[model samples]
Target: MLKSTFLSVACCLFIGHHAFTQCIAGGSNAVAPYASNSSNKGVMFDITATNTVTISCFDANLPALSVGGYEVYFKTGTYVGFETNAASWTLLGSEGSLLSIGLNLATPISVPVNKTILAGQTYAFYITASNPILSTGVLTTTNSGYSAITSNSDLTVYGGAGITYPFGTVTANRAFNGTVHYILGDPLPVEFLDFTAVKVDQSVLLEWETESEHHSDYFEVERSLNGIDWNRLLTVKGAGESSVKEIYQKMDDNPLDGISYYRLNQYDFDGTKTSLKTISFNNKVEIGENDIRIFPNPIIDRFRVFGNQSELETLKVFNSVGEDISGSLTMTCHEGFTDVVFKDQVEGVFILKSKTNSQILIKK
Candidate 1:
């Protein structure tokens, strides 16, 4: 249907349970009347954080950005380097006019980029509009000097503007005007509490629970023999908006042989769809849970037999500070179970991972 999700915040599926901070970057506005041009030249930034982060609200200053909003385009690498690089530009999506900071009007709302940025990656964006903003910076042929606006510890601002919509070539450095905001592992789609797919005879039963939902429309169930190619099984209606836990179920009557993956995707009312999560269910399945789980979530120091133990080779523990302290754990092997003892004085949230399964252990 050609649903344009390129630049809409609807593409953002927030699943983050912790860590949120906002930061602002400085910029220079037009001194004189800017000549009206229908192209986009936007702020550029680089991620320096060690971990991957989700950036939602990044405000780009579009001078004379009028009643009609702007359509934003994005590209990786530097603007000047993309001339013959053959890496085509991407349609980043759009922002509402009410969210834009212009017309010396009412306070503008924050617009979201909703992009998950990896460490050490650089990005640049250009805007296109029907009633283009009137600014001298809109149509600059030469390098207007570099606009280095580094703000938060996560994002460092860089500068580059292009010719017009579908812009490629760049002269030197362009003025970067905007704000950069990011969150450490912030995920917000339909807050999925848990998604599980079970084998029931020849058919597979898919059931999921959501903690909360916002602007949600419907759910699409897809099956993939391999994790790559997917086919839609059916569509289940959504709750639209809800605060309490919402339960949804879909059954796949014709189950595939061996192991097949079931993926759940949620679409907003506007048609922006995001994959919630994927689970692998084997036709020949075990009666118990797919993954061996951990229990007695809140544990103290010393001997804490919180969860069930299975023979695992890959076992690692990470503390709340994102430090790997897997070596500190002392494991006591018994006949049927293993008693996992923690080091004394170690507290806070810890992640215990074995193979594909991870259990969150909170020290109280």
Candidate 2:
């Protein structure tokens, strides 16, 4: 991203536009540095992908601040485009002696490659400027000579020959022709330090660390029983912007039996999402006698286990009337209820067995 010190100005300008108020110069002028009160000028051209355009601007002795930079707004029509199409660049202040302050009437400004543009699209490029003292300077637009001015302040008509003053007067020989360019953004915003998943007793522990993050919003921890159908377990808030290493962890208390897969989905503040590599861990733990108890016999698709189950580990479901069914058991506890979900189990009576207790569960 091409960042500049004029970010605050751009933000304020965009916000003011939202309020339906136009920023005007001292009196009736649309804005200083800009010539026409109508906010349109003569001549426009199209710039293609990754191409470069040179714009001309001059800082003459004016009431505005003498130093600092300005903003550039580009769009396909006479109307300004979205805020994303706007960019700010640096401007050279008056540097020479007093007599030669306005000597450089046409300063060349180049559109950087980082600024993106659509291919095969025509755009009207213009400047929205403010000097160091927040006053508009007498800056002139640099020209590329792609079109001639048909009339002043009438960008809809062009190709005669002459320059038009901002106040809408046509001169015999002057034109404003600035080039527009296009380029793609080429940079990664996040760097991962480490990501790992481990089996912690009856639960799965997922931990990931990022070396640095930019515009990060949050991380979604996704769990999968078969690595095909994934479910979001939790979303951890991220540091909006960070340069230092950040560590995050998520505990999947209700992980599927045998093997459970986990991955991290990072979302940027701009809504861009990226997924980290998936990791699988065996979540099956050996069942042993403990102090937990399952209750409410003849259960439905689910059942609960309670009573001193805080220390209980392994849980499994079995067919009470036939051979051990080919189903996976997943468990999670909350509010004194250990939720047991059976995958691939048919409707019938089943055995819900934990480290400490067993109960007859009915699936209807």
Residue-level lDDT tens digits of model 2 in 1-364: 1122111110000000000101111111111133321212222222323222121222222222244333333444332222121211111111211121232233323211122223333334434333333333233343334343322221122222221221123322223332222113323346553345544445555666665688888988877777789898899998888887577867777767666667667898888886644555555433233444333223334444543333344455567565544234545545334555543466555655544466555554
Q: What's model 2's TM-score?
A: 0.29
Task: Give one clash count per candidate, in the order shown.
Answer: 18, 11
Supply the TM-score for candidate 1. Answer: 0.36
Score every model by TM-score.
Answer: 0.36, 0.29
- Displacement of residue 310 (Cα, Å) in model 1 is 66
